[model samples]
Target: MTVFDDLVGQAQATAVLSRAAAAGAEAVAGGRGAGMTHAWLFTGPPGSGREEAARAFAAALLCPDGGCGHCDQCHQVMIGSHPDLEAVRPQGLSYSVKQTRELILRAAGAPTQGRWRVILFEDADRATESAANALLKAIEEPPPRTVWLLCSPSPDDLMITIRSRCRVVTLATPSTEAVAHVLATRDSVPHDMARFAARASQGHISRARRLALDEGVRRRREAVLAIPPSLTGVGECVSAAERLVKTAEEEAGVATAALNETETSELRKIYGEGSSGKGLNRGLVRGGAGALKELEDRQKSRATRIKRDSLDEALLELVAYYRDVLAMQFGASVELANDDHRFELDRLAQSSTPEETLRRIDTIMRCRERLEANVNPQIAVEAMMLGLRRP
Candidate 1:
């Protein structure tokens, strides 16, 4: 197996990356080839494996045998433990200029052991304008031995200057068959469930795996699917909105609770609170308050982001349900993403006009935009539900 093995259905990308890895190996051996570049930009839609491709490329660059998948360098890159590799994943709304500058400074150093120093920045599109500017200088005149790997949804999401400075590696959405096969082989998921989840995910590999493995995810999606057929009027719409918001909050809470606690504990330890002494020294504790407060602020921002992500997932599910309805209404022979909800889709299609179904889809998309724009989730989703109600 090679480093590119896990990048499902990306044959072109895999071939390019393998060639590059061979070049890198040759460069290490005092020869030259086409694979080595100062920077690489990986662009793909969500769950299309952009970040995975970046990580694999980094591993390949660090591996002497050109990314032997079972080697120590490859394993370390997979788990993000390699000394020559720095993987950045933005946790909150946007990466800060300070963080960008720090990483740039660190990128100036030579590789400790490997032939190249690799910085893998995931969600590079989430960088604030200032952060992006800070990153620009590093890519423009990168250190001779350092490589930058930036992952974004699309090159258009980044500034033109930055995109122009990097070699582009585009990943396509995997086929349902590819995703289902991975779920069954890698995760040991049952064939039927894997196929269903793969279809429902619409080519999102991670979501397909989650849907196959997590009963909670399946239940949550079912709840969202139940909404369309139950929208009686304004009252029911409001109730449904409340239910969606509550469910999103609960899911986000479950995701962040342990992370928040671990961070808090680490802070307390650093401030001497958890030691064997007389608790935290009052003076040290007082001085550390500002740091703790900043951390909490970041955590709060993260929690908000988590809630928005959860709500967006639900909205996507709702969108699929309506799309299935539209397909049935038009007598389209295309397969349904939510075939398990065929009864509801058929009922809704028969009861509503195609125009009405399209309008509801528009409303759901608008709600998603509003949430991204920081509108109150309840208000945006409630308005959407009310729009979805039959006259």
Candidate 2:
């Protein structure tokens, strides 16, 4: 097997990266930077395996065999334990300039054991403006043996200076058939459920896996889909909005609760929480308050980001449902993404004009934009539900 094998439906990108990796092996051995770009930018839509692609590419470059997929070198890269590979994933909403400078300092060092140094940075788009500028400097003049792999949704998400300094590898959303095949073959999901989740996921591979296997995810989706039919009056619309926002919050809380507690506990222990010995760094113990406050701020930002992401997923599901209703109204021959809701789709299609469905879609899109602009979640969702209420 090769490092690129698990990258489903990205034949073109796999081929490009494979050739680059082959060239990279030669460059590393010959002590020449020929036939390899020092920096690469992986751009794709959500669930397009941007981070996975970066990780695989790092393995290929680090492995002596250009990614045999089973060697110790490849395994280390996968687990983020390779001495020469620096894999960074930003947990907070933004990566600060201070963090960027530190990362660049680490990247500037020579390789320890591996032939070349590699940095795989996920969510490169989350770098703050000042941080991006700092990153640009490092990418512009990276060490001869250093390689940078940055993943983002699009080239536009990064600065032009940084974009121009990197070779671009764009990945496309995998087809439903391809996603379903992977779900069945890799995740061992049953055929019928795999197809259903694949269709509903709208090309998001991770989401398809969750929908196919996670009962909580499935129930939450059902609740979101149940919103449209229940908006009979203003009060119902208000309640629907409340329910939608609350669901996002609940999911975020579940995701962050244990993580937040673990981090807090670790910080306390480090700061002499249960100390009894000559921890004569009482000054350091007193300094824990400031560090704790910083950690709290970061956790809050992370929670907010997760909550917004959860709400965005719900909004996208609503968009898909209305899109199916619009398709039914037009008598389109194409298959519906929400085919399981055929009864409701048909009823809504007959009761509403295509124009009305389009209006509702526009309203949902507006709500998504408002949320991105940092409008209060309750207010934005309420406005959307009110607009979605049928006349």
Candidate 3:
């Protein structure tokens, strides 16, 4: 199948990209746009497949057969192995100046394929000011036959100067039905299960897919959604807060440990044995120390991001729980994401008024804001739990 097949529920976006590719092809044929300046900005919500769209566009631009799915160029662009397509995804919280400089240098060179040279800056919002400025210069006056694609959540998330230099392509979140249909058709999942996952994910495709495929992800979601009904007292509220923190810690540990092992192995390869703790090799020792410090810094950033991401997911599940309670209170026949816990939701609906559920949702939203403001995740979640426990 075509690379565009991976993008779910973005028909409008697909159309826009397809038109651009067709225009680029026409330009090449007329010799007026023989060497097209390939620069684009793809903006959309999380899990909206912004990067997937970019990859498809890149494949279409490079494929002489007009993105014929079986072509070598299309396959390489889709898998990120194309000789002329460079994708820069930040490893940590933000792209560094060093990385930006490297990318700029790479962009300055001519393409080996004698076609368009494409550079995709994924999550461009994560670039530091210096990195952004460095990239801005390249975009302002890119080399011939060079194209730059920047992906972010929104245009406002990027510097206006950089945003102005590229063409903007916006993607909307797909409807639940659309997402469910894609999962059923593409992933071969059962229809009911796909619909449940799609509704629970709130239009996030990757999360919906994970919820459909992974038992652990579904279990974690069920646990999070079950918390509101269990909060009968201070003890229970505290217990819920503790459980959330432990889960965040466990998930963060998994991410950091794997990252740490890779960094340690790379460092060891760079510095031979007997390089630690002595006057044996001063340069190697200093280099090793610096590398380890950099790794630790990145690991800390990753841990923070993982914790925030986990809490965000938990918040979404909590919102769904309250929504189900609201639906029950209104005597609505709409399906619930947590249908398996209908008994608990019924109890919640009976004990808490509709206003109470709305307020609880507000509290969760505030906690999300607090976490985004760099507050400690544990404190934010605890405060939310206590608020949710209120009468």
Candidate 4:
């Protein structure tokens, strides 16, 4: 399949980009029109293929055949080896001014391979104010043969000045059917498993893929989904809270340990263990310390975010369960998100009122807000569990 095929449920975005690329090519060939713009902003939710779309467009722009999937140009862009294409992905919490200046300097130069130079800012929302200002200046009056692509959750996530200067391409979340099709066709997963992952992920492609591939993920989800009916007392509420905290910690530990090891190895290589013999190499020591500090800081931030995201996923799962409960309460026969949990949900429907289920949904939403507001994830989850357990 083509790169465009990977962008599920984004037909409008694909059409807009295809047309733009075609028009740009035509302009170049006919020697007319206000040549291609130097900047583009791709806005979409996480796992919505915003960066993938940008890369595809970049490939098309560089390829003579308009992104023939098998061509050298397309292959190079896909693997990130294209000389004219540079992608800036933040390693730490945010892109620094130094990194933005480096990109700006590169953008000021002529293309090394293709007719135009391309710079992609993946997750531009992570850029610091100084970095954003530096990038803004570059976008304000880019070099003649330069093109910038910025990816973010939405146009509002970027500075108004920066947003006003670029063309915007928006992508919506894919449907469950689209996600299921992708899982079955691309990953060769079983149809039933693919459907369950698609429905449970709530339109997140990467999460759906993970849920399909990892048995542990599926098991964890099952455990979370089972919590609603079992939370019958204060002790059960505390136990649920403890379990969620432990799960988040385990996931965060796995993520951070891998990153920490990589960073530590890189730092050791840079320092070179007394090779200089210059009495401790204070500069190298300081640099290594700073890098470790930055790595740890970013890891802390990421851990917090991961916990909240994990909790949010659990909340969504709970919502789906309750929604089914509500439907059953109202004597509706609609399809359920957690059809596998039908027995448990049916029990809930019989035990609780529809109004109580709605209130539980509201509590889940407030828990999400609290997590977003930087409240302790464990505390927010604990309170949510307590509220869910109340009669």
- Clashing pairs in model 2, backbone N/Cα/C closer than 3 A: none
Cα lDDT for residue 87, model 4? Answer: 83
TM-score of 3: 0.89
TM-score of each: 0.95, 0.95, 0.89, 0.86
lDDT of each: 0.90, 0.91, 0.83, 0.83
Question: Candidate 2 regions off by >4 Å?
Answer: 31-34, 276-286
Tell me the tens digit of each residue's lDDT in model 3 across 318-349.
Answer: 88888988999999999786777789999889
Give a tens-digit lDDT track for model 2, residues 1-391: 9989989789999999998998888777775546589999999999899999999999998898989999999999989999999989888778999989999999999999757899999999999999999999999889878999999999999999999999999999999999999999999999999999999997789999999999889999999999899999999999999988998898889999999999998987897767744452563557877888899999998898899999999999999999999998888997688999899989999999999999999999999999978899999999999999953
Clashing pairs in 4: none
The numbered model that scores best in lDDT is: 2
1-391 per-residue lDDT for model 1 (tens digits): 8888999999999999888888887877788766678889999988899999999999999998888899999999999999999999888878899999999998899899959999999999989999999999989999877999999999999999999999999999999999999999999999999999999998999999899999988988888888887888788999999999999998789889999999988987888876755557662567777878889988988889889988998999888888999999999998799998788789889988999989989999999999988999999999999888852
Candidate 2 at residue 114, lDDT? Answer: 52
